[model samples]
Target: MGQAWRDWGGVIGVSACALPIVVALVVALSRWRQKRGVPARVAWWRSAAEIGAVAGTLPWIWMILTPGEGPRQVHLVPLRDLAAQAAGDPGTAVAQVGGNLLVFAALGFFAPIRVAALASPLRLAVLGAAGSIVAEVTQYALDLGRVSSVDDVLVNALGAMLAGLASRRWWQDDVTRPLCTS
Candidate 1:
């Protein structure tokens, strides 16, 4: 936990400090939407979801893109790095797996609430995978001294799918059906 904080404390600190700005943005956007005739509940939720997604996601992205100490590594084999990590220290395993899972969790949790197209868990998984792929590729291209692993993608997608499932009740169901007469 101390080591984890050392690694992520700066990003976490900045995010915490920005909480007020995030809240203000959410409130401002909600008010604007309400003024535009949207229902208050819908406006508040949509605005909060949008702001929360960006606010929660950007810090993780910043951390992922930050350069590391080790040589740049690529582990294309699925589960290879995860197995190694799991076989090593338990704390490291949890942190690595947990961090990877959270890479897109915010987007998964909040995007569906704002966009009906992204309401499905499968879609969230795919989106998370795609986003992870981009991050991995970027890490390699930038020589960030990070391991680009397929397991990271898998875990990230799993996290997103799980988060999407958690937020399913709040998802925007835009489907409309004609009245049926019996």
Candidate 2:
């Protein structure tokens, strides 16, 4: 436990400190929305979803953007890095895959709840891909000593889609609409 804390103390500490503020913000925003004539239930869900998205996602983004000691690398071929990882140590592969999947999970899980425009699994997947691309580009441009792999985008987008599916019950009403006519 101590070793785990030492390894992740900063992220843990910041998340701990932010918990109270997040709660207060949620309450204040919910009340403000109510004062503005929004239904209490609707306002609470929207406020909580919005805040939860940011609070849950930012730490992962921060960790991804952090510079590493290794030289920067890029992998344009999709699934190549993924296959390599799959063949590597089990722990490393799981961590890499799981971390990538979780990177935008909160956004996927909450965005449709808060905004009707983002109510589809396809939309969530696209959004995740675009966001992942931007992060990969930033990593390369900043020489952050990280590997910018297409596999990351693929996994991230899939993860978002999966999370969106999990939250489909709470998505806006139109979320059930068909993806295509054909």
Candidate 3:
């Protein structure tokens, strides 16, 4: 079980990071293709991307919702001495937190581009912030294997904002035309 969580964490971390972006791109591409009335090599790719993203994040959804057997235990540790000192490599903990934050950020920035948002970065930030809260709440409630941390929340928001800002390029007429037609 411990081994599974560890492996699953890595998988979730990666999927949570990648799936959002994939979903956004595929949806945009597919919508454009449909509008053009062409049935090229897109439907399969769209389905594959959507399925991959869903498959990747499902384990995380399960982990967050299922209550485990033991009573909950909360530990307070200084940020500098978390998973690393406890497991003998604080560097790893910091890296993991950073990675998770970026994952959510990418989701925040890209998801809007995929579905069309209010066209505001602030709105994107709010969406990202809300998502972070949900994940944190899940960790707190599940008490299964994930630690609810403030650093994680901050990192996630940072990622979302960055992604949102970067997505500005997607709105440009030149890029949009070629990407949609292709």
Candidate 4:
């Protein structure tokens, strides 16, 4: 855990500091447009969501892509090693599972709110899985001293689907009226 922090702390800290500013900027822009009688095509909340999603997710991505000081490893069998590891070290298991899930959670939670086409859980899951696959493949291809595993993709997609379900009430496609009535 300490090693992980040392590798990615700066990126995480920067992202944490930038998120509020990004949201604030989007809110201010939305208000400015509204005051000018120029109705927003996209909801301000959606804009904030998009920014937050990217800001929150990018640091994790950087961590995943950054090569460590060892040889790369690959785990082809899905969940086998994860299950073993869980049995051995519960704390590490929790952290790994939770971290993988969170990687794309913001994207899943916010994407459907911003784009009507992505409102379905299936779509969000596929999107999340695809993104995770790309990241895993990048790690393997780059020999980034990281373990590229199918389990990561599965967990990531599951996380995205869960987040999508949580945000179902605000899905853009579910709304009957325009976001801006003006």
Candidate 5:
């Protein structure tokens, strides 16, 4: 649970917030310089490809330091006492969801900025899975006080996909809509 929160919140969530801003900034600057309207940031599909590649691999980097099971970077919540009674408690679920979404979102957001070939959702899934796999495999290999879990990979991948979906339009057209649809 501790690790989940870290993976999701620390990594995924941070990425979600960060990547888009950077991508937008770059696109904005490019527009500022262009004499004609900034040419739609290389088409919608192109943006997707760019976003996917970057959105996919970030999880493996931090997995190295993650321990097997954790109270991990402890946050103060009064419910810590009842942790033993539940497997699907609200607190635990929140951690898992938040952490996974964050890191994956980060990947999604950064994908456009970090890599130029991430336009396809399928491709994004591939990279996202790859990142999760590497993290799990690395944990297994190093015996670095962590155990790899398929669930993490699945959640991470899903989160990234969601991020991609959220930015579907960003990948499709240079036309800005809502953050999720834009």
Candidate 6:
């Protein structure tokens, strides 16, 4: 809906604006390292993935943590809030599900490629869940007027795990011999 899009306009705009800068910086850094007689082990995609992860995630986080006019809300029961939302507005429900899944997707997809220790679905899920928990706790603590629900955490972890699975082929091969040293 127009309202939903308008509400999320800032987040979308920020990510869109930062994308080109991130890519350019990544390219420049890659070139600089290569020119210094260092192997270009850090592929452009890796940099893009990392930068994109942060750029795409931060705006949503800001939106999440920003306090609204209303009082904060918490939903301790798993899926209760989600079910209610889905029943009320299917479109909103779908958008929420997709957004939650995507929150940590880039990190999940590219982290394993960059770090051997994180080259597993379980690790990615745990990491995503931990990050989601922190976000929820922050929302609750700050009285951000957002619903802190277990469903969000579960869905976010699921998204990360799925992303890890999607990148499994690359991770399995890359983990044995890391491409770049962080």
Which parts of model 3 have CA positions greater than 4 angstroms off? 1-90, 115-118, 172-182
Q: Is candidate 1 or candidate 3 better by lDDT?
A: 1
TM-score of each: 0.92, 0.89, 0.53, 0.84, 0.52, 0.86
State residue 53's C-alpha deviation in candidate 3, in Å.
7.8
| Each model's lDDT | 0.87, 0.85, 0.55, 0.81, 0.56, 0.77
Clash tally, candidates in order = 0, 0, 4, 0, 26, 0
lDDT per residue (tens digit) for residues 1-182 in model 3 = 47545745775676668767777776776677667764544443433334443454354445444554555544444354234534765665655655655555545544444444424677766766677678767767757655666555555666677766776765332322224445
List where candidate 1 sits over 4 angstroms from the true fold: 172-182
Checking candidate 1 for backbone clashes, the offending pairs are none
User: Over all chains combined, what TM-score does candidate 6 have?
Assistant: 0.86
Better of 1 and 5 by TM-score: 1
Write the candidate numbers in order of decreasing TM-score: 1, 2, 6, 4, 3, 5
Model 3, position 144: C-alpha lDDT score: 66
**Candidate 4, lDDT over the whole model:** 0.81
Ranking by lDDT: 1, 2, 4, 6, 5, 3
Per-residue accuracy of model 4 over 1-182 as CA lDDT, tens digit each: 89757877888788889867887877886777567654555446655666767876787798778887778888889888678878987877888899898889988988888777888999999989999999999999988888888899999999888998898888844332345445
User: Model 5 off-target regions past 4 Å?
Assistant: 1-60, 68-86, 110-117, 174-182
Task: Summarize candidate 6's per-residue lDDT along 86-135 as a digit string, tens digits.
Answer: 88878878888988998778778777766768887889999889989999
Residue 8, model 2: Cα distance from true site in angstroms: 3.7
Positional deviation of 140 in candidate 4, in angstroms?
1.5
Q: Which of 1 and 6 is ahead in TM-score?
A: 1
lDDT tens digits, residues 27-101, model 2?
Answer: 999999889777778778888889988998888788788887789999998899989999998877887899899
